[model samples]
Target chain A: MAEKVIAGRTIQVNDEGYMTNPSEWTREIAAEMAKEEGITLTDKHYAVLEYIREKALAGETLTIRKIGSSGIVDLKEFYQLFPGGPLKLASKLAGIPKPTSCV
Target chain B: MATKEEYPLKKVLIICAKGNLEDVYAALVMANGAVMEGIETKLFFTFFGLDAITKKRMNCLHTATVGNPALRMPGGLPFPTLLGILPGVEAGVSAMMRKEMDKLDIPPVKEFLEMITAGGGEIYACKLAADMFKLKKEDFTEEVLDIITVGQFYEMAGGIGTQIIFV
Candidate 1:
């Protein structure tokens, strides 16, 4: 048994830590997830989220540590902005054809 | 079994020092390759490289002449330096290069920068070069993220897997 819902979606996390349906994920999905997590999704949040997703889709596989090193924004602020946090947000929004472990 | 690391060259920093045809072409090739490989690419233009981004000089970049072996004339004819001085020679070469790039689906320098930035890559202008060249912020393409020092560029390039390349 694995966690089905992190923020809002009924996502299935495998034992290997991959999202079952990563292709269906999008920035809007992440935004909605953030909302369900009790966080407001602002344009700036979307910008950062989208940027991260683009990089991930490009196959960057950004970790929280790597995200922190980017210097695009503060890590603490990033945490507060995204509901599922960097790793989840990056995985959900990365636009990868399939979901793999982002942890 | 060992799993190979995927998405090599995740972070690329392209230092553009010349805006001529070969230089700009080199930068574009590298940047495009990085983008295709899903890497985060950044292009920092300095000195002559700034010309590639400037509105006035971008379309007017010249071809390199000195020390280029392919520039020799045929039939044992000595290549005339005056031909380079002729009007539209540089423009013609630039046009041809642009056509070839377009055929290859490589975006223009400005649009390429936009695509890179839009795709999660950062673009920066060299502050020292900008100041030395007396270039205002408005003089550069709007895709420029900021005017940063070389140290700042290093800071961006500093990471476990980041790569810094000069093209």
Candidate 2:
């Protein structure tokens, strides 16, 4: 584990940079991480991120299929929202643990 | 101390030569998973594996109840090969398998292919197998980009950090 200072607040993160405590996340922190991933978080991106964080916190297994049916963005749009490894990147940007799903 | 270097796979060429439900799903899941990971993936179906892309048979794939020793009853009992010979047993087992996979949010063959293509993964069918089975281009689902020979497939498979998998 590592302590990362993001958006001027220190947060606990795992080795791969996923926040250990998602409750520490903020829009500013997400914006900083999104910039690291070369993404510009729009309202559309935030909608999907928020939806995913909610499902992930409730212990729902996150998959591309589940995200496609999320009604906010379809699978293709989700991929475009966070290009490479969408679910993984989204989880990290959403301040959740790295996703372990393979689907 | 010497440290191991990492060379992640950049491309995957997956070949599915069997038509069984498990075989086709395995290929699809791998291809989909790879594409989702930002790896370039090409799926090639050959021999009976064409059933996975064939429009009429794609969604109705059957598990080999008779020969799959790993098959089991719902309660984890060994599924007898003799019982597999009963009429409709294979269909029932295949349906059960689909249901279980659905519970895991796994999609049917059609949607799986769609998901792969939507993510820019290309799907192909073996030319020889298609010719032998009298399958035309139109016989396959639209997800199949083309019917190609092994030579063409290998040509595309050539690259650093590329691996070819046969299922």
Q: List the residue pairs that clash in candidate 1.
A: A58-B38
The estimated TM-scores of all candidates read: 0.56, 0.97
How do the residues B1-167 of candidate 2 rate in per-residue lDDT, one tens digit apiece?
A: 99999889999999999999999999999999999999999999999999999999999999998978899998999999999999999999999899999999999999999999988899999999999999999999999999999899989988789999999
Error of 1 at B99 (Å): 2.0
- Clashes (backbone N, CA, C under 3 Å), per candidate, total 1, 0
- How would the docking of model 2 be graded? high
Q: Roughly what TM-score does model 1 have, to 2 decimal places?
A: 0.56
State the lDDT at A14 in candidate 2: 91
Give residue B47's error in model 2 in angstroms: 0.6
**Residue B54 in model 1: lDDT:** 84
In order, the first chain's TM-score in every candidate is: 0.55, 0.97
Alpha-carbon lDDT of model 1: 0.65
lDDT per model, in order? Answer: 0.65, 0.93
Q: Which stretches in model 2 have alpha-carbon errors above 4 Å?
A: B1-4
